[model samples]
Target: MGGEWFEVLRPPYLPVEIRWERAVADGLPADVSHAFGIFDTTLCGVQEAGMSPSDHWWLPERESACDACREAAGVIDDRRPRAMRGEDARVSVARRL
Candidate 1:
């Protein structure tokens, strides 16, 4: 129920599930996942803390929880890190000095 918004944001070639996996595989930009996670957590509370959508917003389909996970996730502050210069960071083989 909470992922309704996500249903519309379909990317061509990659299905939603695959895209999510790709994001994980490619190491998605932290800010993008972090912020979105916060919003999503707010809608569907965490289980470890005994929180669920029914706890506050009345999700209609799920049971109540102790507290929402979004609260724990906190708000997003988008200040992306800058790219490193000089060398290719991912080069596995060490270069000869």
Candidate 2:
């Protein structure tokens, strides 16, 4: 049988079932719980959503997203060009110095 597949990600400190609450506690608008279903599939359906290794989902359009996630996305976005040039390691390290 074929079935649609989905992914859900949540921080470890928060119960997986109450991930939405964690989003709210983190200062994101409460409506976010409804804006995107509390899963990566629905989260990615929202424009410009980002998933982190720590199992957090962020909407890139929202200024209210977790700072570290947004900044991490920004760092990755900033590196795309250097990566395309085949010099990501050198440039990424140089930028940190």
Candidate 2, number of clashes: 0
lDDT, candidate 1, residue 17? 20
Clashing pairs in 1: 50-66, 52-65
Candidate 2 at 71: error in angstroms?
0.6
Q: TM-score for each prediction? A: 0.15, 0.26
Give a tens-digit lDDT track for model 1, residues 8-95: 3211232122212101113322232211122224322311232122212322222322123233322211121123222322223444
lDDT of 2 at 53: 24
Pick out the ten consecutive residues of candidate 1 with the lowest summed lDDT. 16-25
Task: Give the per-residue Cα lDDT of candidate 2 at 17.
Answer: 30
- Residue 95 miss distance in model 1 (angstroms): 3.7
lDDT (0-100) at residue 66 of candidate 1?
Answer: 16
